[model samples]
Target: MRLAPGADLPVEVLERPDFPVNRGALCGKGRSAPALLARDVRLTGPLLRDRPGGPLRSAGWPEALDRVAAGLARVRAEHGPDAVGVFGGGGLTNEKAYLLGKFARVVLGTANIDYNGRFCMSSAAAAHRRAFGLDRGLPFPLADVPHTGCLILVGGNPAETMPPAIRYLRELRENGGKLIVVDPRRTRTAELADLHLQPRPGGDLALALGLLHLVIADGLVDQAFVAERTSGFERAREAAMAHWPDRVERITGVPAHRLREAAGLFGRAATGMVLTARGPEQQSKGTDTVGAWIDLCLATGKAGRPYSGYGCLTGQGNGQGGREHGQKADQLPGYRSIEDPAAREHVAAVWGVPAGSLPGPGKSAYELLDGLGRPGGVRALLLAGSNPAVSAPNAGHVTERLRALDLLVVADLVLSETARLADVVLPVTQWAEETGTTTNLEGRVILRRRAVDPPEGVRSELWVLRELAARLGVPDGFPADGFPVEAERVFDELRRASAGGDADYAGIDYARIAAEDGVFWPCPAPDHPGTPRLFLDRFATPDGRARFAAVTHRPAGEEPDAAYPLYLTTGRVLAQYQSGAQTRRVAELNSAAPGPYVELHPRLAARLGIADGEPVAVTSRRGRAVAPARVTEAIRPDTVFMPFHWAGAGRANSLTNPALDPVSRMPEFKLCAVRVEPLRSQQAGAEPAGADAGAQSAGSDTVGVDAAGSQPPGADAAGSEQAREETAA
Candidate 1:
């Protein structure tokens, strides 16, 4: 919270002790959030473009809303509602996420709706559902970390991404608990670990399999627990038996002895846990990789017990809540499957709509973006809170698709990379200017209170949605009592819609949240206090037994080839967030990390004839990105690292692979293959910077190779309005 002496004076931000999750701890990003409230950097009015490739000019709210509504409505009328896709962000409050899903399903009648959270935790969610029949980042509270006897932190760097959360790890060490960190780099969190295993990028599956193999060979498996509380251990153990420690060592670049030591520490602990993050959850085989880790927990009797389980560290602020609601393509409110009849009826009844009116499941996030501007695909898109142009895999191609859209509407607080290419930009309020609820990584629902008023021209997304719905001839779709934008009113509706589903919150309300500071979900009734820890006695599955998945290690989608010889991995810097849309605006954060740079081992830099701080052109099969070389011994000699926060030539995602995970549909953002060269001449400097090279020869009309190594069709002009309308009728 901040206190101001006067309207024109500066404000002071103080940590709130009342916030149960953070516990009066604020990270660098949280501390610098106040700087984003500056009126100059914030978008205060709507901007509209007359046509594609036309100039954008300021417009009144009515004209802007009318243009957006009419554009989307026209597309819906011509090609059916499925022709218009709705894309959302993980940062949206639970109210906005719920309403966005409702707007897409009820008003727009489109199933092509998903959010950026697909990239954040879809793999973990998928694995959790497969084993426990439910997904929450942490089944137990974060406070349990210190009490656990052994903690294995896999592919997450909380020291930079979540500073407040790092306290738990430190406390674990102080309490005589062992900390084993697995990452490619010696991150700040890894430095505090008793054992740090630096595996090759995208090799987490192999590493986990080796650990399980060693555990089983050493007789560390809990036969009693596996026989009573789990199924399919024999199959999982059989799969692990083939992956010996030496074979995994060859694949992961980790020593066999180190693997055995780490496995022994975790398997022998009284209370052990394994936690994963984006590093393992953003691969082409992310779902199976996560399943492998969960199998280890199940075999060792670590899961479904106090202070021990497999969990994911969610990236975005409200990522867990955002995905639980209807924003995800395959999900309805309360984390219910969109294909389930009972789930559909429950949510539809709350919205006063027929269950049959809901569209079937559509494409996932990356698939939706890839389908833009193609024939028989979505022609118009409505995006909110995400900047895929910079954060998405194969970002150069994503930017091209945005340019190809007939109508691109973006709602954001700033002119982000994605917003810059929008046909209409809707200025929206920020966190301090609105009151809403968000679910943290631990499934704790916390209230975010408004501390100040938004600028005059800015409005909430709820208001924008309500006004747009009325303009689209669904004036009664949004309720009058809270349609124009009230957070608590929307939350009340959410509670009812989530009554009996996987993420039940029927008993939770605004007043209860305020009084309790924060409450865990599955509060089915007001008389029932919120569940702080789950699966203490039984799993959420129908038979109350966890399932083990038989998974194996596989090469990444894009492996090092003769042409693209070195591996490229992308991540975040301490001072920046996912896309740097808001963090870059803060002068303090900008000063800490001014731009992107390519980090490579000194030997690799020497082989390429590139010195520290020299310009390097990194070319992948999909695109190219240019950044200054940063020679460091911390990284592997065969790999290069870059932070994916900046836009344009420095954007690391420009050269990333868009290989989709088979089940999760998450793009392989963690690792890809690229060739690097030191800049030599002016002609080389003038080459197309960060330009996407489609997987086709010049003048060829064939489909290009997508992230999954499959050839998809080339872009085609959308159907004519008259032709589309005939099909619709």
Candidate 2:
């Protein structure tokens, strides 16, 4: 970040010129970071609603903290500790993420705790861990991308999502490397590929299997590497052989010749890599689908080699770190399993708590949200750094679950969609005004320096957690060092808890991170240099061999039927960040990508008599949403794409399916069955569906961002009036 000395706001947010990943480039989201600090919509202090369905009002720190503590205590006393749920986000710093987990278990002693990161890349993480006994977004850094001979990008559009990283793809092609892109649409990233395979939605598993079959048939399998460094290949091979090119073509809608061609390109290359994003990872069969992709890498000798492996393109800030720390549902600090007794002992010791006192893994993100306010489910929830109301799959249902909660506490920088519905909202400090550590996609731990002071009355998450813990009646100061409010103090304890663990951050300190420009993880000792490239000589498995998954293609949880004859896929746009909690409030960003629109194939649009920019109603089994049509040949004929960054009328997630991967517990957010109908009589607000989500003032604030897709007669206008009356009251 380039800021004038002592200035309240940054002059320009520039990428580090020497950084290996971004390499002197900044994406629109990165550059717009300053706009968040300047926004008037930022929540300056705590807000409380004393009763159900009551309007929130300002409260002092003491009163608000007391109310939150009392509510949580009431829930625990009435329904037991398990009823108090703690929800976190991927955007939180590692300290905050770790502290949140500690707060849930050590303070409140609840098992019902999870975070939004589960929605981002849980499937990929599961597959990676299953294959290599460890889960890192990328074993090799982004710097290895340009050097690889061939790159198969599955379900990722980094050109739009991560503009700065596109240079690697461009350089790969310039250096004569082949790029094969697999997606249901010919996205901007796909346009750059040497071969673009537009498969059917949720057909990525079949596509990967087809590619693997061809690799073996063409004698491209690395027999020597597989025999020496892998296990379970025979079963995986059998599964792939069953998925012949012709059979795979039938399922994925890709021609056999193209599958063979894509296979040949990857197989012929001396080095190769496969990277998947939400399109493949956010599915009911996402774990198996990702396993299929990893199987391809293993078959082609891509694992445990330089510039070759399977990686996940994580979509959230601190995504790698958030999951590695204690925030995830099933993990302890340093990515240790919560079910592991030894891991429990170590983390408990660090937290100064009895090992037996720690709670077991509760539920994944969607399950926790889905269980809200139900019998024997979570009654009071403390959510921080996430806006599941807009981001969750089957969002309409999730939003209502949130509303049903007896106590909803949200800590955020702005009045986010989830915050607006919060019974008690605590204004929290954001990135620029908070100092902490974040692990980037490459497993690099970087120290975040506070550039400026936060506005008065705004507290840091560290302070919030400490105060809450105190109010919850911790005898000692708490968490070893009394839950010190300083980030450095908390980090020192994190280093201890992470020692000798999978992600091993003991060697990494604030000093080391700053001096090294960010240190990669598995730095087990202070003298040991961080492992930038993992699994070079040996994989992390018990026998020093990567495991190949024996998996086969399965149909999506919900396939297109007569009632819902089309596939609905959701993704990110260039100008908006996840859930659009902060990005949508930025005027420049909102102007660039102001509204959500359904991207449909030209033929599909014509068949439905829907012109470009015409409002189209997309109805699914769960709900319905209305958005403008973007008719183009870029998308598949049987599929429609919606960017899941908006709310209200165009809230795409409302129509997404909640069918979850059994292993990863990740919802099928990317694909669901839906029907498109051209709207002729309905008209919602014209200022896009986003402005209504977190609007501050009443009457003028657009309303009716429903948990249900289709509203009743005059519900939209009536919602607006109700919002006005509430704000006035």
Give model 1 RMSD, 1 decimal. 8.3
- Per-prediction count of colliding residue pairs? 1, 2
lDDT of 2 by residue, 234-286 (tens): 99999899999889989999999999899999998999999999989999999
Q: How well is each residue in 1-729 modelled by candidate 1, as lDDT tens digits?
A: 352211222555666776656679988788878776766556767777765665555667999998999999999998988999999999999999999999999989999999999989999999999999889999989989999999999989999999988989999999999999999988889899999998889899999999999999999999999999999998999899989999999999999999999999999999989999999999999999999999989988999899999999999999999999989999999998999999999999999999999988989999999889888778999999999988888887887787788899999987676776788889898888888999998898988887677777788998898898888777865645542247787888999999999899999987898898878998898988998888988999999999999998899998998988888988988999998888876767877887788999999988888999998877887777777899988888988999988775677888888899999999999999888888663243344443632211111121123344532110111112112212221
Give the TM-scores of the predictions, in the order they appear: 0.93, 0.93
Poorly placed runs, candidate 2 (over 4 Å): 1-15, 475-485, 681-729
In the predicted model 1, the residue pairs found to clash are 659-707
Question: What lDDT would candidate 1 get against the real structure?
Answer: 0.84
Q: How many times do residue backbones clash in model 2?
A: 2
lDDT on C-alpha atoms for all candidate structures: 0.84, 0.84
